[model samples]
Structure formats: C-alpha cells, structure tokens
Target: MPELPEVETTRRGIAPHVDAARVTELIVREHRLRWPIPPELAEHVTDQPLLALERRAKYLLFRFPAGTLIVHLGMSGTLRALTEAFPPEKHDHVDIVFDNGRRLRFRDPRRFGAVLWQNGNPLTHPLLAALGPEPLSDDFSADHLAAQLARRQSAVKQVIMDNHIVVGVGNIYASESLFRARVDPRRAAASLSRIEIENLTKSVKETLADAIAQGGSTLRDFVDSDGREGYFLLQCYAYGREGEPCRVCGTTIQQIRQGQRATYFCPSCQH
Candidate 1:
C-alpha cells in the first residue's frame, strides 16, 4: 500500500494538471472497488471545475464547488493524469475526463481502492472524520505524541502505527522512525520519556519528509502519477535490512514480527 509520502507525491504530481480543470465526463469501468464508486458521481461532478487537490491521511481529495471526490489507493492502486489519447489498461477502473483533453485515470488490480463522492464537507465524512493529525504537520508534534502514548500500553511501534494516534506512519515508517530514534520497537509506549518522545517525533517527521523529497519508498506496485517509481527505499536504514550491518554502528540489523508486521532494527543501537 502507498504510505503518506507516496500518496502526497501522487497528489503533487497530478495537482497541476487536474486542479481548476473542468470535468467533462466520468467513466467507471468497474464500480466494485473497496467501496462501490458512487452511481451519480458523474451527475454531481461533471462540468464542475475542480477547485483544489488535497490529501488527508491516505485519501486524495478533489475539491469542487458542490462537494469533494475522495480517493483511496488501497493496496495496489495508482492514479495517473494522462492525455485524452492515452489508452486505458486492463485494470484502469475509472476516468475523470477533463474538458482540456486530459484525464485522471485510476487503476487498482487488487480492487481494494475507493472512489467515493461527498455532497457535504468531506473532512466531516465518516471515513475521514476521526483520522488523527497529519504526521508532517505542526499538529503532530512531540507533545501530541507523548499525550497519546501516555495512554497506551501497547508497543511503541504499534502505537505509532495507529492511525488514531498519528495518521500515515505506516509499517515501514514506524520501523524506520523507531530505528532512527534509537528506541526499541518493543518498548511500551507509556514507558518512553519526554526526551525519547521528542527524538521519536523528530525522527518521524524527518524520515517522512526525506521520503517525500525522494518521491517515497516503492517496495512494489507504487508509483507517482507519472508512473515513476520512488527511490527512497535505497536509503532505508533498517526496515528491510534484516541481518545486515547497521549503517550507524555496524551492528547486524535484526528483524522481528510486531502486530504481524516485520520490524527491523539494530539491537546494539536501539534500546
């Protein structure tokens, strides 16, 4: 699945072409996604100019006058901005044809993605209403993280991965952030000191910011709107380097299962 950075990268890639463009038509090749594509999606959005493009957590928001179009690139979904002449592929499930002869295409082979419509404030919609603060925003600082962690006895890794605590810190990021903070993933969330929280918060922000700058980490089936793969995976410190020497201490990186997800760290470095 595409994490925050990857999602943000897609938003940035397609925003220029789609923003302010008028939707000429809506094409739904398959409505049966994670949630069925709205049946009257075309009626509501057609001929309407897209006001803006924003990302909330993992969902993409296409803002218009009437409402917003919310998109989630589930496990293996990709959205591309293509010229009108671009041919649709096998899994291309939907298209928002623009009056400018450009189209935004959505493809999801596994069919777990979503294309939904909202007639009211999209931020108040159930899917997004309770989502925590964006990890890259000022709202997700050390103070916020500490307050949340203080109430949870779960493993620090699991706590950080919880969307309710801080949205978009996915499995890979959680491991990498903990490694950077030199905090063991298995430590209880409430056991972290103020200094540890500060370090972890800074690490999370830096890791995610760096990944976004590098265009996100592409493990598989993830690409920007331009069909380009991300290069951040090349700089990973511990996420997938199990049994490899740590970059900082030359300690062999270890891997463990936390909440059924693989976590990597340097036992000699992370306490």
Candidate 2:
C-alpha cells in the first residue's frame, strides 16, 4: 500500500501536469475500484479546470468549482501523467484527458484504488471526515499523541499506526519511527514516558519527511508519476532487513508479526 510519503510524492509528481488544466474528458474503463468511480464523474468535471491538487491522508484531491474528485491509490495502483495519448494497458482503469493533450492514467491490477466525488468540502466527506490530523501537521504533537496514548494498552507501534490517532503512520513508518525513537515495537502505548513520546513524535515526522524526500520506499508497486522507483528502501534501517545486521548496532534485525503485519527492529538498539 502507498503510505503518506508515497501518496504525497505522487501528488507532487502529477500536480504540475494536471493542476489548473481543464479536463477534456474522464474515461472510466473499469467502474469497480476500492469504490465504484462515480457514474456522473465525467458529467461534472469534463470541461472544468482543476483548481487545486491536494492530499488528505492517502487520498488525492482534485478540487474544482463543481466538486472535488478524491482518489485513493490502494494496494497496487499508480496514477501516472502522460505526455502523449499513450494506449491504455491491461490494468489501466481510468484516464483523465486534459485540454493541453496531456493525460492522467490510473492503473490498478488489484482493483483496490478509488475515484469518488464529494461536493462542498471533500474533507467533510465520510471517507475523510473521521481521519485524524496529518502526521506532518501542527495538530499532531507529542501532547496530542500522549493524550491518545494515555488509555491505550496496545503496543506503541500499533497505536501510532491507528488512523484515528494520527494519519500517515502506516505499518512501515510505525516500525521506522519506533526504531528511531529507540522504543521496542512491543512496548505498551501507555508505557511510553513523556520523553519517549516526544522522541516518537519527532521520529515519526523525520522518518516520514525523509521518506517523502527520497520519493518514498518502493517496497512493492509504488512509483512516482514518471514511473520512477523510490530509493528510500535502500536507506531503511529496520523495516525489511530482518536477519540482517542493524545499522546502528551490530545486533541482527529481528522480525515479528503484529496485527498480522511484519514488525522489524533491532533488539539491541531498541528497548
């Protein structure tokens, strides 16, 4: 799944081509996605200009006067910007044609990505309404995390990964952030001290920002709009280096299952 950084990277990559560009047409070859692409999608935005491009959580927002087009690049989806009208591939499900002759192609082999419409404020839409503050926003502070963690007995990693607690800290990032904070992934959320919480908050921010700068980790199908693979995986310290030597310590990185997801850490470096 494309996490915050990967999603943000995609937003940045395609915004230049799509922003302020009038949509000539929106063609949905496959209506069944993470959610069915709105039937009236083309009716509303066919000739309207995209006013702005934004991201809330992992969803991309294409703002226009009529409404906002929200997109979620689920498990194995990519929205690529095309310089020319290239023929669609086997998995290419949606295409947004621009008046300028450029294109935005959405391809998802697993068919889990979404293209939905929301009137008024897209943030107020049900899918995004309950989402917590962005991990990079001022609303997400140590105090906020502490307040959320005060009563939770779940593992710290699991708690931070909760979308209601803080958005964007997915499984990969939770592991990286916990490793950077020097906290064990198995530590109870309530067991973290004030200092640990502060460090964890900072670590989360740093880890995410670094990943975004590196174009996000390409662990699976993630790629920028240009079809470029991310290089952050090479900089990973723990996420997928199980049984390998830890970067900070000589201890071998270990992996365990938490909530059915892999959690990697260095036993010696993290408590």
Candidate 3:
C-alpha cells in the first residue's frame, strides 16, 4: 500500500494539472473498488472546479465548492496525469478529464483502491473523523507520542503504527524509525522513557521527511503521478536488510514478525 509520503508525492505531482481546473468529465470504468465508487460521483463533481488538492493520511482530497472527492490508493493503486488522447490500459479504472485537456487517471491492478464522495466537510467523514494527527505536523510532538504510548501495552512498533496514535506510520516506516531511534521494536510502548520517546518522535519525522524527499519507498506497485518509482528504498537502514551487516555497527541485521509484519533491526544497535 502507498504510505503518507507516496500519497503526498502523488498529490504534489497532480496538483498543478488538476487544481483550479474544471472537471469536464468524470469517468468510472470500474466502480467495484475497496468501496464501490459512488454511481452519482459524476453527477456531483462534474463541471465543478477543483478548488484545491490535499492529503490526509493515505487519502487524497479533491476539494470543490459543493463537496470533496476522497480517494484511497489501497494496495496497488496509481494516480497519473495523462493527456486526453492517452489510451486507457487494462487497470485504468477512472479518469477525471479537465478543461485544460489533462486527465487524472486512477489505475489499480488489485482493485483495492477507493473512490468516494463527501458532501460535507471531509474531516468529519467517518473514514477520516477519528484519525490522529499527521505525523509530519507540529501537533505530533514527543510529548504527544509519549501521552499516547503511555496508555498502550502493545509493542512499541505496533503502538507507533497505530493510526489512532499518529497517522501514516506504516509497517516499513515504523521499523525504520525505531531502528533509527535505537529502540527495540518488541519493547512495550508504555515502557519507553521520555528521552526514548523524544528520539523516536524525531526519527519518525526525519524518516518520513526523507522518504518524501526521495519520492517515497517503492517496494512494489507504487509510482508517482508522473509514473516514476520512488528511490527511498535504496536508503533504508534496517527494514529489509535481514542477515546483512548493519550500516552503523556492522552487526548482522535481524528480522522478526510482529503483528504479522516483518520487522528489521540491529541486535547490537537497537535496545
């Protein structure tokens, strides 16, 4: 699935072509996604100018005068900007044709992505209403993380990955952040000290920022709106380097399964 950085990258890539452009047409080739695309989505958004484009967690918000169009790139979804003459491929499921002749196309091989209409404030939508603060925001500070973790008995990585604690700290980023902070993934969340929490918070922010700058980590089926794969995977420290020498201490990186997801860490480095 595309994480925060990937989604944000997509938002930035397509914003210039889509924002402020009038939607001349809304085409839904396949409405059977993770959630069925609203049959009336075209009726609601057609001819409306996209006021702005924003991202909340992994969802993309296309703002308009009447409401917002919320899209989630579930596991293998890719949104791209193409010309009106561009041919739709097998997986191309939807397109929003703009007055400028550019079309925003959504392709998902797995059909796990979602397209929904929000008639009111998008933040109040049930899917987004209870989401925690954005990980890259000022509101997600060390103190905030500490308070949330103190109430959870789950593993440190699991707690951090919880969307209710801090949005968009997915499995790969969680392992990378904990490794950077030198905190063991298996540690109980409530057992972290203040200093550890601070380090973890900083690591999370830095890791995410770096990934965004590199265009996000592309393990599989992720590409920006321009159809470019992310390069962040080349800079990973511990996420997938199992049995390899640690970059910092030359210790053999180890992998374990927590919450059914693989976690990588340096035994000699992370406590």
Candidate 3, 29-130: lDDT as tens digits:
999999999898999999999999999999999999989999999999999999765888999999999999999999999999999999889999999999
Q: In model 2, which range of ten residues has the least summed lDDT?
A: 32-41
Estimate the TM-score of every prediction.
0.98, 0.98, 0.99
Each prediction's total of clashing residue pairs, residues at least 3 apart in sequence or on different chains, is: 0, 0, 0
Pairs clashing within candidate 3: none
Across 39-139, the per-residue lDDT of candidate 1 in tens digits comes to: 99989899999999999999999999999999999999999999765777899999999988889999999999999999889999999999999998999
Give the alpha-carbon lDDT of every model.
Answer: 0.93, 0.93, 0.93
Candidate 2, number of clashes: 0
